[model samples]
Target: MASMLEFRTPGWNPYAVKYSPYYDSRIAVATAANYGIVGNGRVFCLGLGPQGIQVEKTFDTNDAQYDLAWSEINENQLLVACGDGSIKLYDMNVNDFPIMNFHEHKREAFSVAWSPVTKDTFASSSWDGTVKIWSPARKDSIQTLPVGNCTYSTAYCPSNPSLISAVSTDSHLRLFDLRTPASAQYHLTAKIPVHVPSPAPLPQGPSPPAVPGEILTHDWNKYNHTVIATGGVDRVIRTFDIRNPSGGPASVMMGHEYAVRRLAWSPHASDILVSASYDMTVRLWTDGSTMPAQQASPVKAGIQLGIMNRHTEFATGVDWCLFGVGGWVATVGWDERVLLWDANAMLRGQA
Candidate 1:
C-alpha cells in the first residue's frame, strides 16, 4: 500500500520501463503516442523522490520507441529500439539528439538488451526478422543473426555474455552462442517451441487442432542461467531449460485473459517473475519448477502469487529493482501511467 508510487506520462503510451542498475531510484521509460501505430515517441528519465516521481530528462523522437535498454558500462547512456528500424543511443547528459545511431533492419526494431556479462556490447531484435549485435564504439552492427520471423524480445544470459536468447512471432525460443564461429549460422545452438507436445499415448478423445500464436515476450532467469520463461498470444507462461527441448515446458501457468506483452524475472529469486498483459493487469508468479524435468505436471502446479489491476488500459511493461530488498517493481501501461509497487505486498494483499 504505502510502498506504491505512480506517475502519469503526458501525451505518451509507455511500452517499456527499466530500472537503473547503477541507481535504485533512477528509471527510464520508452513511450509512443497514438499507441505506436503512428506519430512520434519519447524517452523519459525519472527519479523517485519523497514527494513523488520527478521527471529528470526527456528526449523526443521522430518515430515510436518500442523498447530500450540501459548501458551497463556507462551511467549516462541508454539504447532505444525504434519504429523506424534504427537503434539510437542517447546520453542523459547530452542534448536531445542521440549521440550514436545504427540503422540496418528493414522494419521496426522491437527489442534491445544490454549484455549483462559483457558491458560494452548490446543486441537488438526487429520486425525485419533479424537480430544484430553492436558495441557503443562501432558505427555498424558487429554481427547479424536472421530469425526469419518478427522477433519480439531478446536477452543476454546474466552469467554468460556469449549466450543469447530470443522469442519471435513463430512461437519458438532460439538460443545463439556467440562463442561459435559465424559459419555455424551465428551459433544458433537451440530452438524450442512454446507449446507442449502431447505426452505418449494420446488421450482417448479426438485430438484438437493446433492453434498458432506469436510469442510476444520472454526473459532469462537471472540466478538460474539455464532457465527461460516465455509468454504470448496463447496466454500461457511456460518455462524451459536450454539443455532439453524434447521434454517440453518445465512448467506452465495460465491466468491471463489476454496476451502477455512483457515480463521480467525477479533479480532476488530465480523462480519468481512478473508479467504485464493486454488484459490490463500485472500478475506475479512462481515458475514452479520442481527441480527441472523431474516433476510431473509442473506447470499445472505453478502458482500465481497475486495480480495488480489498477491500470485502466493494457499493461505493456514491467521491471524489478535490482539494488534493494528486491520486491520493488515498476510497471507502465497504455493508460499513460507508470506504477511503482512492492511485489511482496501484492502477494500479501496489501497493495
Candidate 2:
C-alpha cells in the first residue's frame, strides 16, 4: 500500500516563517529560536531579555514560507514549504543552509506539519487539493491523503501520530486518521435516502453552478488531543471536537475583522491560545465559556472575539515558547518587525 521516492536538492524558503523549537532560555543549551522574514530575506532570533528585537543571522533566500514547521529531529533543523511548491529543510547545523530540499507540490504548499510520533515523518497540503504524508525514507505519498478541496492549513495530532486535522478553502475542516488502513479496514461508505432534497434552483437562465468555499487553517491542543481549532477565509475561527466537527464547535473564539490568518495553541497550557489575522490584529482566546449568546455559533462567533492591538500591520506569523522562562508569545508582520509579548501581562492587566 506504500512506496518510496527519493531526490536531493536545497530546501525552499518561500515565506521564511519557520518558528524555533521549544527553546531553552539558557543560550548555551539552546539552538536559538528564529523566524526568517522572506520579503527582506532576513532571519530573526530572540534578543534576550523581555523587550526589543535583534538579528542573530541573515541569509539570502528568494522565497516565502507558505507553510512551515519546527523539526524535533535536532535543534538546528527547520523545514519550510514555500509558495514555489518546494520544501526546504534547513540545518543551522550546516552553516545556516538547507541540508535537504525538494519540490513536493505542483502548486503553492499552503500547509505543513511535522509528525510528533515519528522522528523524520511529516505531511503537507497545498492549493492542489492533495495532502501527502512524507518521510525521508519514502518515494511518494506514504498514504496519499484523500480530501475534496484545497487544504489551507494542517496540524498533526501530537498525541496520536495517525490523526491529522486540515482546514480547506471550502469552509470545511477534515480529520484524517492515517493509522486506519488505506484499503478496506477504514473505508468510507455512505448511502443517500430515497427522499433527496431538491438542489437550489439555478439563477435565471442556465448558468454554471457556483463553486463552494473551502476550509482554511487548523490546530490541535497539545494538552488535550480531542480538541482542534480551524480558521477560514469566511472570516471565522472554529474549535471542533474531532469526535464531531459538525455536531457543533466546542467553543468559538472570534475577533478578526477579516479572514483569520493563523491560529496557535500554547503547548504549556490548554486554556491559552493566540490568533493572527489579515485584519492587522492578534487576539488571545480562553476556555471560559462566556462568549456572547448571539455569537455562540460558528456563523457569528468568528467575528465576535476580542482583539489585541499589539502589531501595526498584517500578522503573518504567531508562536509561543513553551520552555522559556517567561513563556513569551511572538508575532511577525508585514511591518518588518517581530514583536514579542508576555502572555502574563495581558492576563494580569485584565485582573
Candidate 3:
C-alpha cells in the first residue's frame, strides 16, 4: 500500500476527522464553508478504497460545523456540533436531512465526544460556557455541567462511564464524576489549572512562572485513565494526572510554533500521541514517562518523535487508524485537504 493518500473537500474546510470504530475503510469529517466564519456547514462520510479517499455521503446544515463523533451504539449514525449552538444526528442510511436536531446551547458547539463505555450517551462543550450530556433518544440534555467559561473540548473517560472531563478558555481542566450526588456541586469532581509552574525545578535553573492561557483541545490517554493531555493558545501541550491535580503536569510537550488545534493519544501505545496545530503541521510525541532519560531527569518532558507538514493551512484534526498495525493516521485541515499516511513509515524514515 502507498504510504500516503490525499483528498480535497473543495470549498469546505474541515475542522475534525474521525475514523469509524466499526469499519477501517470508513471515516467522517466535519467541515465549514468560508473557514467557519459566515457560511454553511457539512458532514462528509468518506470511504477509503484502492483508488483513494471517496465521499460516500454528505449532510448539509445552515450553521458551521466544528466537530463530530461517530455513534458508538450504531454503525450507521453520527453526531455533529455546529456554530448555531446545535447538535445534529445524521444517519448514513437516511437521505439528505438529519434524523434529529439538538439545539439547547446558546453559542457555537465546539466539540462532541461519545461515551466509549456507555455507548448510548455523548457529551458536548460549547462557547456558551457549559458542557451538556445527551442521549440520542431524547430531545433535551440529560444534564448540563457549568464550565463557567467557553468550554472548547469535553470527553467521557474511556474506562469509566460515570466520569467526564472538559477544558476551557479559563485555562482549567474540570472533571465531573456523574456518580456523585448533584447537590454536591453538579457532580463536579476536580478543577486543575493546566498552566501552573512545575513543582520540580529544571536541573539548569529554576522553572519559569506559569501564565494562564486559553485551552483549546485535550484528550485522555486511552491506556492511562489518570493521565490527560491538553494544548491551546499557549502553543504548549501538557499532560496532567487527575489523581494529583496539584502536583502539576505529569509531563510537558512543547514544539508547535502556533497554537495546538487538536490532539489524540494513540490507541496502541500508552506513551504515544499526535497533535495538529495552527502551524500547518501534525507532530508525533512520546510523553517520555517510559523513556530511560526522562525517568532519570528531575523534570519530565515529552520528546518529539516526528512531524508531518504537508497541510498548507491550519491542521485542525487527526485520528489514528484503530484496526491496523496502529500507525496509519488521518488528518484534516483548513486547506480543504485530508491526508492519510503511514506514521510508522515516517518514523522509520526518521530513524
Candidate 4:
C-alpha cells in the first residue's frame, strides 16, 4: 500500500519470486513466455535500490521455469525448476550458464525449495507426481517421495531438517518424514484432504456435494511450525494443524474471486499472511488463530487486512522480506510486473 516500486520482465510472465535469505535487498524471479503454455523462459536476479528495483543478472532457458529457490548454504547460488523436467543450479558470481543440472522428473518440475534447517539440501515437486530431495554437490536425487498426483509445491520444514510438506492436484496436503524407510514411496506420514465437507448435516436447501480441486500452493507458518496454510482452485484459504489433522482447518479466510495461486506467511508475525490469486489482486489476512501450541481453540473466519489491485493478470508469486520492519513484500504476476509495497501502511490506510 505504500508507494510501490514496480519493474517489468519484458516478454515474460513471472511465476515465482523469492527474496534471498542472506540478502534482504536481493530477490530472484522465475518466469516463462506466453504464461508458460509454450515457449522459453528466464530467471531474473534483481536488487532493491533507492531508484527502485533493477536487474542484477538474467539467465535464459529453453523451457519455462515454474519456480526457484535461493541456496541456503551459498548466497551466490540458487536453483530453478524447469518445464523440461530438470533442475539447474546457478551461481550468480560465475558465467550465465548453470554450473550443475539434475534431470530425474519425467514432467515439468513445478516447485523447488532449499532446506531452511539443513542448509545443504533442497527438494523439488513435479507434474510427474513425485517430490525429490537433492544436495547441490550430488549429481542425482537422494530420495523421491511419490504423491500419486501432480504435485505443484514442495518445501522443507523450516524447523525440522528431516521433515517436508507438499500440495498436489489430488487436493491433499501431505507430510513426509525423511527419517522413515526409503522405499517405492517415501515415508508419507500424513495426508489431509483440503476440501472435505463438514460432518454436520446441512440446514437448508440441497447441499452441494463437496467439490475437490487441485491445491495450487501452501506454506508453513514460520512462527508456528505445526500450522500450515493451503489454497487452491476452491478460492478458499484454510489453515490446519498437523498435530490434529482430524479437526479440519483451524481457520478459513475467504474473499478471493478466483483460484488462489500463491501464499506466504509473514516472517515477523505468527498470524499474519498474504495471498495472490487469479482474480488479479493481492490480499493480506490474519489467520485468526493463536498458535495451537499456545491455545486450545482457534478463531474461525480470519480477517482480511487489505487488498492491492495493481496487478492486471493472475498473481502467481509472493514473498516477504525477512529483514524489513515487517511490512515489505514482493509480488510477481502474469502481468509481467513485480511490485514491492508495504503492507503495514496498506492495512492502516496510510499508503
The C-alpha RMSD in Å for every predicted model, in order, reads 2.8, 10.3, 1.8, 3.0
Worst 10 residues of 3 by lDDT: 200-209
State in Å the error of residue 161, model 4: 0.8
Give RMSD (Å) of candidate 3 vs. truth. 1.8
**Each prediction's whole-model lDDT (CA):** 0.87, 0.56, 0.92, 0.89
Q: What would you estimate as the lDDT of candidate 2?
A: 0.56
Relative to the true structure, candidate 4 reaches a TM of 0.94
Tell me the spans in candidate 2 whose CA falls farther than 4 Å from its real position.
Answer: 1-19, 25-52, 137-141, 184-214, 289-306, 325-327
**What are the per-residue Cα lDDT tens digits for candidate 1 across 279-344?**
999999987653344334333335788999999999999999988787999999999999999998
For this target, which candidate reaches the highest lDDT against the unseen true structure? 3
Q: Extract clashing residue pairs from model 4.
A: none
lDDT of 4 by residue, 174-258 (tens): 9999898876556988899888764443232222235889899999999999999999998888888999877777777888999
Question: Per-residue alpha-carbon lDDT of model 3 for 159-239, expressed as tens digits?
Answer: 999999999999999999998899758888899998898877543333534999899999999999999999999888899
Question: How big is the positional error of residue 226 in model 4, measured in Å on the Cα after superposition?
Answer: 0.5
Give the per-residue lDDT digits (tens) of candidate 2, residues 191-301. 111111113221222221123344455678777788777665645555666665335555555446776777788777776677777787877777443335442233223
Which candidate would rank higher by lDDT, 1 or 2?
Answer: 1
| Reference-based TM-score, model 2 | 0.75
